[model samples]
Target: MKNLQPIISVESDAKMSKCRTLIMLISPTLVLAIIPIFLSFIIKKLILMTFLIFFGFSSLAMSASDIYFFIVILLKMRNNELFYQEDNKIYILKK
Candidate 1:
């Protein structure tokens, strides 16, 4: 059987690479922030810990939003691959 992978264009591949690069850039800071967050919890600093947890979660949410977009693009590519071609047009099975 033939492979059913999406035919990714270079432009979109580059954009995904850019998104991955941004994630790589942010990950280190997020990792570093974890130590302080943990320390605040251990020291029983409720106010500081609460604030840090919120801040950390907000940054994580930003990364998650980026990932969500990336996943949507990947799903679109997969859907494109799943279609059949006819008369130079494309379609999928139904029924």
Candidate 2:
């Protein structure tokens, strides 16, 4: 009897490079998500802390929206789909 399971090594340098790229791309979003918690830990003033928390969350929301737009555009480009706009909405055609 012979072992038939295939093994793939992700420890190769090329695979590590891809892993690093993924971490780099995702770290900003992860850090932004944690900013509110970090602010709470550092700020002791109730009023200023509230403002910082508000702005931090607002910025996170804006960043998330931008990420969504970027993903949509990337998908459209990769799928060879045409994007159109109507009433502030985006429409993509199936290719």
Candidate 3:
């Protein structure tokens, strides 16, 4: 039988793990936030610009809150058993 488990590395150092997590969280948020600003520049319509600016700001706000909640969850889970979900199954990490 093929092993149908997700492999998660739990041996990474704390600093590196934090760095990786931040990058993952920030990169997409930055891209989404910046795209609207850039589009507003290329688009000369005032209405479009206003809409884009609003969208950009709202996305930034939502992303910030999402990142905050994600960090909170991580902190809360730090001492708990880590689990990974794949194909509707949850696998607990063995420390």
Candidate 4:
């Protein structure tokens, strides 16, 4: 069978590189902007813990919010998309 797939040319490769560079640059800025919201949640948790401590309830169990945040961080650390090139076509798989 003759292969009929189009090869990725240099210009498209350059464009992809530029797109990746732009994403890399913008991701950190977005993270920075979101930090304060995460910090506020942590601060709120600390205050709740302090109140519990003062009331002599010393059991410090993980809250649902804490687990949610942890999962979110884990998800963020992993790539959201898987790119596969098959039969000369690009496929993006999202988690």
Residues 1-95 of candidate 2: C-alpha lDDT, one tens digit per residue: 55433242122222122223335435555576557657866989998788777766765765674456556454444344444444434455544
Q: Residues 1-95, candidate 1, lDDT per residue (tens digit)?
A: 55444343112222223334445445544574555566667766778888877776665654564456445544554432333344434343331
Note the Cα lDDT for every prediction shown.
0.49, 0.53, 0.61, 0.40
- Pick out the ten consecutive residues of candidate 1 with the lowest summed lDDT: 8-17
Candidate 2: misplaced stretches above 4 Å? Answer: 1-17, 65-95
Off by over 4 Å in 4: 1-19, 45-95
Residue 34, model 4: lDDT of 40
TM-score of model 1 relative to the true fold? 0.35
- Model 2: lDDT equals 0.53
The candidate that achieves the highest lDDT relative to the unseen native structure = 3
Regions of candidate 3 where Cα sits further than 4 Å from its true position: 1-16, 66-95
TM-score for each of the candidates: 0.35, 0.38, 0.45, 0.23
- The candidate, 2 or 4, that scores higher on TM-score is 2
Per-residue CA lDDT of candidate 3, range 22-44, in tens? 46556656787879978988999
Ranked by TM-score, the better of candidates 1 and 4 is: 1
After superposition, candidate 1 runs with Cα above 4 Å error: 1-37, 66-95
Ranking by TM-score: 3, 2, 1, 4
Q: Give the clashing pairs for model 3.
A: none
